[model samples]
Target: MDRTIAVEKELTPVIQYLSEKGYKVESIEFGSDYSKNIDKYDAVVVTGMNKDFLGMQDVVSKIPVIEARGMTAEQVYWQLNTSLKQ
Candidate 1:
């Protein structure tokens, strides 16, 4: 089955790359909307920017949350894939 992923809006390169790889990609920002429907996605890619300031309050899930800070899109993909396998 094609995996669905929620990615941060700023990660355009990552989004495109993942989409090309046949995953259903949805652009998302950390907020009420995402928190409400977090379970729908297999994983989430976050920028990890201002996480402390912005706060992901009350948001919790078993899915992997990839911090795409300095990592390349390929690296992020690898990590995501790896995490899901286990």
Candidate 2:
């Protein structure tokens, strides 16, 4: 499945690199204008949540969130891999 990831900045080097390799990455600033429905995406990737969107009740459990903070690429990769299986 293709995953839609949200990054704070556009073409962020960190996210860009991941996208170049094969990740479906998108840039979105929560509570601001966005190109698409943040929840419509299969999976959500947050690269350090902003105060406005981080603690918002709407996002807390609406979907599966893959927080970029407090997580390593290895851990994320494994989680994604395992999720795909189930």
Candidate 3:
């Protein structure tokens, strides 16, 4: 199955890179209600600096979250790819 990833809005470069690699990518805002929507994705790529914006820990515990802070688009892509391999 194609890997579906939810990427935070601030990581536009990462989104573009993932899209180019053929992964289904969705843009999500930092403070949005992700409880109902998060399950649709296999993983989430967020900025480490904005990790708290997703709200309570319970809401994000459902899936693996990859922090993209201080990383390039290629690095983020590799990070997400590695996470999926485990």
Query: What lDDT tens digits, residue by residue, belong to model 1 across residues 7-84?
Result: 989999999999988889998777765676788889989898856312455556788888999999999999999988
Please report the TM-score between candidate 3 and the true structure: 0.85
By summed lDDT, the worst window of 10 consecutive residues in model 2 runs over 54-63
What is the model-wide C-alpha lDDT for candidate 1?
Answer: 0.84
lDDT of 3: 0.83
Score candidate 1 by TM-score against the native: 0.88
What stretches of model 1 exceed 4 Å from their correct place? 52-55
Query: lDDT by residue for model 3 over 1-86, one digit each (tens)?
Result: 49899998889999999999989999988565876667778899988886475666556455678888889999988888888888
Q: TM-score for all predictions? A: 0.88, 0.57, 0.85
lDDT of each prediction vs. the true structure?
Answer: 0.84, 0.57, 0.83
For each predicted model, how many residue pairs clash, with residues at least 3 apart or on different chains?
0, 0, 0
Tell me which residue pairs clash in candidate 2: none
Top model number, lDDT: 1
Please report the candidate that would top TM-score against the real structure: 1
Candidate 2 versus truth, CA RMSD in Å, comes to 3.8
After TM-score superposition, what is the CA distance of residue 33 in candidate 3 from its true location, in Å?
A: 1.2
- Candidate 3: segments with Cα more than 4 A from true spot: 60-62
